[model samples]
Target: MIDATRPSAPPRRILVVDDDAGMRDSLEDLLSAAGWTVTTFGRAATALAKLPEVNPDVVLADVRMPGMSGLELLRELAKPEMPPVVLISAHGDIPMAVTAVQEGAYSFVEKPYEPHRLLSIVQHAADQFRMAADTKRLRARLASLSGLDRVLLGQTEEIRTLRQDVLDLAESEAPVLLVGETGTGKELVARALHDLGARPGGPFVAINCATLEQDRFEMEMFGAKDGPRGFLGEADRGSLFLDEICSCPERVQAKLLRAIETGTFNPVGADSGASSDFRLISASNLEPEKAVREGLLRADVFYRINTFVLRLPPLRQRLEDLPLLYSHFLDEFAAVYEIEPPQTSHEDMAALLAHDWPGNVRELRHVAERHVLAARRGRGSAAEAMSNDQQRSEFPGTLREAVAAFEREMVGRAIRAHSGRMDAAAEALGIGRRTLNEKIVKLGLDKDNWL
Candidate 1:
């Protein structure tokens, strides 16, 4: 029986395999000197047999041997939970050693190896193994936390059913089409799907299709010579989320179709093609089938993405979630401002619920931020501010004019409340002090008469 309390042993078990008895002894001496529990086997088959008993942390195997070559030993140990294998080879065996690494060997060390180099490789392999294990544990924990029970935030039957669908689709790699209006949290659902899936460690890349100009759409999606690699390449081995999929131009749609089918794309101006192994999740405010019928989207592309559709209910449809979402946003903004969350009166909730939220959750978020800022500036309560909106009946001439008027009013209020303290006013408005000063100068609010 191996003594578990041996002082000369390494911190973990290390198996050394070499055909030559002298080489095996030398390796064992070096590894043992470095405080490892070293085990030596002259034959690769013997080492393979001992592996089940020892459960070594790392295997340092000589590539060329009499029987059961290092490559063969590596293949046998490729089973799950097996320790990482490091290949040792001669100068002439560099090509084979490279092949070994490609076949899942942790690393390759050329022989006759320097003791320090061998020790470095062993330490690195052990650390990488530990990191991989830790990441797996973290992913499992995240998945458990983000389970179906936790994902669906509301108790409504619609939300409950949607949550179940999300859970079911989380296990699949098929493309998902999330149809929702702007600010409906489509990206949030996409992330949940990726996290709950098998390849949680893979990257998640999102592209807002509506934000890209029509002429630049192809280069942005497929990558350009002067620009960084596009979203598709960036999301290799993970997921790519295309927001506002209907806005993807006809030319770009053609490239996307080819990429989805072949898992390959040639970067703009690149001669060679690169392959990506990733899942697709796309979102759009417009109905994809309707868009295809209108000729705004390709029929084939629509069919390809319509495999699994998840329609997010608009805020108006799910008014029950308003109170919870409102309170959540209140707490979020309050924490950022370092102020206690403002109290919401029952009348305020009623008014908020009654109003038609054309801007959806994004509008609600801004309203909450504005309310918090107003409350901080001694503007009574958020509800009182809403009641005052009825006093301003005359609408501004233009949209830009209306926005500027609202900005002036808010800035004026902040300035008066803070006794002309621009810094405090800027903080309340969530704008930089310099920016507030620039606006004040531009809008002719620098005079005391404005205050």
Candidate 2:
């Protein structure tokens, strides 16, 4: 089995800086024979000047030198694009070699170089350097991309088709029903429909039926007595997005169907409420047909909202997008926290691609967030950290535990994404205000940590 812990790729290139003509020649001959492309320099200044052209994966320089010693050269190359530098030193220069290593030097080699050990160190250093370089490239690509290409990112056919559908459907006011499994970005698609639709300037009122208590469903959807208008009223001349529509009570679903048919709703304590001229958008984690068959949704209501159904592909269905999405999330979170983006090894990426990602994009997002935190702490590979999380999420001992675990993740993500604002997070998550507060206490979700 591949260890998947250490890098597997052979060293590609090295930059050798040594004053002695004989030493540089010997090192070049040795590394070249071992499948490495080598570039040598007699002075650190010359090597530093031509660093861009060289672009070596790793650097080998002698610690003791006349001017601009290897230690000084290491400091000069300490910028973001700097490759790993391994300092070659004699026994007497070991102290300086230690300091150089502490100051970002990859490693040190004593005067009598053991060829195998030197090669091993160089290989690891190049791996680290290449990893960082890859992250920079991903960031550059992400920054260059624009519009929906940036928002709904992926090169897969599924994603490409989905983006096209979003654009096509956005031009119309026809009711759109987004059907997909959880974590498949149904709400995102709903928002995109409204944002690109004709009434983009109008209000976008979203409601989550699953989070609304049965008793208050009518008041919440219609209007409260002697209070502000409900979500229906708020969505006048705009878009109203209903998430988890199948979760609403059957009686309310009938009224909702009427409201859609009449384009108006009556408020509690008011003889007549202002007419609502809003385009309806609905989403369900379950398939519309399945929800209707299971009696969770009204057949008439489902048929009405299914004027143009858009299905979101799950993460597993578009496995090719994992690397791109993972790197993109890393860049996003890093930028949010004002930190440098982290990189993953080929092995780590392979492990990620192999996983089924049952939680879909949401699961991947959480994993990316974890890797960013790991990078901030200067920790090891992300794959190791993900093992425990995978076990907890993928193989729970009980159904109740599994449900609780998922709620914690979802609620916590909502809070964090909304910067710890309960109202905002509740709205985003489709959880009721009181339910969200109760969830915070029961689940021990701290707003401070999310903030």
Candidate 3:
């Protein structure tokens, strides 16, 4: 079995920097024969110059050189981003090479070298360098990617169509209106519109309109003369996301509509001539049309910004995606907390899929985090609230009835976890596939729940 803790090593790159051309060629050929991609440089300066371009996993340099000595080259590449450097020299210079290793070199290798010993040292250095590089790359990816894609995970028909809609919307400059129930990832969709759009390089400024106090709404949207910068100015030449747009006060909505229509806005206390530039992206957990009819959202404002409307589907409507979404969150929290991800038992999976997920993807993520926390604290099973409160409230009349209910729930979860793969699900439940199928039938568990 492959150890999960071990990183898969990519092809190693070894940079050989030696002033002796014959020695450089010899080292390069030897390392290349050992399955490494080798680059030979006759001068340390040349190697340093090519460092960024070649990005060798390890550097093998002779201790003495004409201009830039191996020690000097090691110092130059001593920064965090540089790969490991191994210093080499003749027996007479072994002490100097050892001193170089003490300073920062990966290791010291003596001349009249043992081929296997040299290969072993270089291989270890390269593997360590590669693992560190992989970690850095993962962190970089986590920082740059907005994580909006995770919200729209799964290969279901609904997700496939939604992805296409998002791609189509990205090419347009029109204002986008996102509608979804609370926790259905409205904000994520709003971010996706801005991030995937043609103006992705521009800033993405977001504010929750519903949370803004009525008195401070204007000042927050439009900068005040003697107050802090407004979201409008901050989002100039970029996207301004107004979350819970339907919650914007009626009077403020009129002013916002004017700004969108005229491509200018009046800062709270600035001269009437002062104007702001920005693209608008709005979201509402409420149904936009209903909100307008109920006077919560201004009809005119809705018309002004509803050029492109997207509705995020609730989690319950996409039950088949539960396993994938659960795994995604599990992996995310595992990485964040630096712990091995906890496994979802048959019962735990059933509880996850059976829940309506009223809070949608956001709720599921929080639950997954809680599961991780619980597992770290030595609780191997799913947390009590893994199943919804309403569902758990039902009481079995007898102890035998309660035990049966528990068994049924676990079977259901196992099936769902495996996406109705009976053999795999049964194996996870430690039962033969035929026996599991019989139990499912006897328990009267709805196959639709897992399928």
lDDT of every predicted structure (CA atoms): 0.78, 0.81, 0.79
- Give candidate 1 regions above 4 Å deviation: 1-152, 225-227, 383-451
Q: Runs in model 2 with CA error above 4 Å?
A: 1-151, 391-451
Question: Ranking by lDDT, best first?
Answer: 2, 3, 1
Index of the highest-lDDT prediction: 2
Error of 2 at 190 (Å): 1.2
Residue-wise lDDT of candidate 3 within 112-217, one digit each (tens)?
7889999999999988887888866754453246555678888889887876687667668889888776777777777777776667788899898756766888
* Model 2's TM-score against the true structure: 0.55
Clashing pairs in 2: none
Indicate the residue-level lDDT of 393 in model 2.
60
lDDT of 2: 0.81
Residue 254 CA error for candidate 3 (Å)?
A: 0.8
For residue 91, what is the lDDT in candidate 3? 44
TM-score of 3: 0.54
The alpha-carbon lDDT assigned to residue 90 of candidate 3 equals 74
Model 2 worst lDDT window (10 residues): 142-151
